[model samples]
Target: MTGTRFDPSWFEAHHVNLSATERRAATLTTRRTVKKDWQAAWLAQAITCIDLTTLAGDDTPSRVQRLCAKARQPLRDDIMAALGLDALRVGAVCVYPTMVAHAVKALEGSGVPVASVATGFPAGLMPLSLRLAEINYAVDQGASEVDIVITREYALTGQWSKLYDEIAAMREACGPAHMKAILATGDLQTLGNVYKASMVAMQAGSDFIKTSTGKEGLNATLPVSLTMVRALRDFREKSGQIVGFKPAGGIKSAKDAIAWLILMKEELGTRWTRNDLFRFGASSMLGDIERQLEHHVTGRYSAANRHAMA
Candidate 1:
């Protein structure tokens, strides 16, 4: 989904009430609960929306292949059968730009896309040309999705036009690949800034406005995510274009997964709960989800190491 042209009015007047936001966020987990068969169903849906990820320094082709293997079959066959599921797969496999080809080759014909982090991931302080070139490199290597980090300096300095131009250029470079703009909300200082940054990214043509790069000091919090999704809902009402949301850090449990799913459903409707509109950028989250599912099936909690990730 292409974004609208840069429009400051769309979010300039936007003011996020910290108290109200925090109060609402606090109720997300408490207001709703799912259990037994319903809980198992929601957990299965969360697996499908996961962007199974591996972005460590020690990553290797073999390790990426292992991650891809897990993406293709996120749940063990016995556990899936117990849940009455015929097939299960994660939304996508995210890796660094250099690892795109390896992931693409490994996940071939599995219907799971390879998402590469480009545009100076985690920091995005590189030159604009270099950042755009990195996105092109990932696309040329067969990545169907590209996750790009926005230059926080631009957002911090309130240079919305420059920020818009930077993200728009990166979006163009993405070509046919879907672009996910990581706002690194933890570093953005305020919920208002997060809201404004989300609007600018959506205006600049981002297919998804993500909460973090999983590298920030603070990651995916309910208040921060709530701010972004409200911005997404506003953008949709105005532009008639649907953009996706991703919460990418500090999310590592089956409980956390269900909490986020509940958020999406309550705030953006059931459509946002699907993998196409929502994704969890997590590496260790899958293991916990699998462990919970196993316990649900066998009535015995398994060791964490029993469900290892790549």
Candidate 2:
């Protein structure tokens, strides 16, 4: 994945008006509608773009193995046949650094990549050296992708230079593994901050810019997502480079997934909807999507219990 060259001045000069951003975000949901089979198809696409994740303190090897099995075959056999999708699968399986080995072992023959959240994940407060080492460890343990959290203090304090340098080092540690820089937008406080941070991460060579860590008080919201998407558009226009986007946390339903997919298509066009360019960092969301697909095919809503993650 080629990354854009770092340009601190470009990000420092960026500005985002909150009111206009909110207005645009409000209309995203009502702007387009995908109904019936079209909606089902969109949901299937959403499934393929999901980074099926299990980031928990109590996550075990068995749990990681089960999650890998689900990632390999995201949809049940009946649902896949009904949708005429014989080879459906999630984009990747994300787990903690320690769980990366387990996930890799379980998904050995499958093509699904194992993603590990590193760099003091969720709360990137550790020292830079340690964070970088953690990333190396995860990659050595067989992680194809590393989701690293940025130091929110840099964004909060308007330290664009520091933020850019930090992300650049993390990217270097990732080496061959793709890097997703989580901005933890919920803590950034403003849309403008979100936009600037997005630019900094992209400029610093992040393959993807993620919305949240799913451990924050608030996570991926429509308005914040819009701000970040527009930032991606600007980055692509100025540098002629395309980067992926991931809206994590608080997205838990088929309807919510379609909403984000529509946002990507409408804002960045069709190219951003694919797994290579977009992803959902979710755990329980797959279950809801499966339930909706079942309803679409069988015309009967099944209990949530019937669609377990593993």
Candidate that scores best on lDDT: 1
Tens digit per residue, CA lDDT, model 2, 1-310: 5666667777676778889888988898887999989999999999999999988889999999999999999888999898888798899999999999999999998889999999998899999999999999999999999999999999999898899899999999999999999999999998889999999999999999999999999999999999999989999998898999999999999989999999999999999999999999987889999999999999999999999899
Rate residue 19 of model 2 by lDDT: 90
Number of the predicted model whose TM-score against the real structure is largest: 1
For model 1, the stretches where C-alpha displacement exceeds 4 angstroms are none
Clashing pairs in 2: none
How many clashes (backbone atoms < 3 Å, residues ≥3 apart in a chain or on different chains) does model 2 have? 0
Using alpha carbons, what is the TM-score of model 1? 0.99
Error of 2 at 281 (Å): 0.5
Q: Backbone clashes in each candidate structure, one number apiece? A: 0, 0
Query: For model 2, where is the 10-residue window of minimal lDDT?
Result: 1-10
lDDT of each: 0.94, 0.93
True-structure RMSD, every candidate: 0.7, 1.0
